[model samples]
Target: MLIDAHCHLDFPDFDADREAVIERARAAGVAQFIVPGTTRRRWPAVLSLGARDDVSVCLGLHPYFMEEHAEGDIEALAQALEANPQSVAVGECGIDARFGDTLDAQWRLFDAQLRIAKARKLPVVVHCVRANDPVAKRLRQLDLPAGGLVHAFAGSPEQAGKFLDLGFVVGLGGAVTFDRAKRLQRAVQSLPDDGYVLETDSPDMPLAGHQGERNEPARVAEVCRVVAGLRGQGSEAVAANSTATARRLFRL
Candidate 1:
């Protein structure tokens, strides 16, 4: 079975047919999902999804939604994690350079979540974009014991090596399915069997043929196939190794 190491199943995009979406994923052999919280307001929804035996959750503030985050939300996050023992990790949080205006606040929020992950001994589910080096640098500073995933990784083989060296595994998803993603394909080719996991970043990041459509957990199987083809390995082998790595990281 394959695990979607990072997906936002709790988002409203799936509200119309969440159960059907999940059933389809199960039918497609995608057995588990990790849904990370994006904001204080969304934590309840995220935690609700955790009630499912096959779904695990993480709590954090996403950098993309910096304006939605209020002061003291970090403390609230800490308390929420304390109260929600089922939470599997600490984020869908990290830096996104596209939003240059909020870069400073993003760092503050990302750093706070990293520290919380350190203190709680939980793995994290990061959303890095165009800032792998900076993210890696920050990660080095913390050296979190329960190293987490760099979700939807679109970095170079060298950068992937950096995260692997730091005890983290990069997540491969829809991005790698594109023919133009040659660099990412190369990174996939170079990853150790245990160095990465698959994700869909559901409700976003549609795959090659499904552009403009909503991505869902069921598509992680395709991600598995593409990654396997890139590595010249069988899909089953990729599924097994990625699943094992994800289970190890989240302790699920």
Candidate 2:
């Protein structure tokens, strides 16, 4: 069975057909999914979704919505974690220099969540962009207790190696299917299969042919096919290896 290591079924994007989406994923052999909380406001929704048999959840404030987050949100997250020991990880949190000026606040928020995950020994689901060096440096400093997945990885092979060395897995997704993503595709080809996982980051990052369309967890089989082709392996092999790696990393 395949596991979508990251997704956001709690988002409004899936409100119309969340049940059908999950069913399609199951029918396609996608047996598990990780739904990450984007902010404190979304934690309850995230938790409710995770309560299902096939889904897991992570709680944290995302950098993109940094302005909406309050200082006490981290404490509340800790309380939620204590209240629900079944939470699989502590993110959808990391740096996003793409927004330009919010760098400091982003770092602050990212570091706080990292500390919580370290303390609880839960893995993290990271979202990084144009700030790989800084993210890598911070991760080195914290030395997280349970290494996590770098969701939607679009970094250099060298950078990918750094995260792998730190015990983190690289998340491969729709981006690798694009013809213009030579660097990311090459990175996928070069990375070791055992330390990598697959995700669709659905309702986002749609594959090449599905550009401008909403993505879904059921489409992850296409991602597996792309990664397997890039790595000169079989899709079933990619699915098996990535599923096992994800389970081990998240203790799922």
Q: Which candidate is the best by TM-score?
A: 1
Q: Give the 10-residue window scoring lowest on summed lDDT in candidate 2.
A: 186-195
lDDT of 1: 0.94
Cα error, candidate 2, residue 1 (Å): 1.5
lDDT of 1 at 37: 96
In candidate 2, residue 239 scores what lDDT?
A: 98
Candidate 1 per-residue lDDT over residues 1-252, each given as its tens digit: 989998999999999999999999999999999999999999999999999899999999999999899999999999999999889899989999999999999999999999999999998888899999999999999999999999999999999999999999999999999999999999999999999999999989999999999999999999999999999999999999999999999998
Instruction: Mark the 10 consecutive residues where model 1 has the least summed lDDT.
Output: 84-93
State the lDDT of candidate 2 residue by residue for 158-204, as single tens digits. Answer: 89999998989999999999999988888888898787999999889
TM-score of 2: 0.98
Overlapping backbone residue pairs in candidate 1 total 0
TM-scores of the candidates are 0.99, 0.98
State how far residue 248 of model 1 sits from its true place (Å). Answer: 0.1
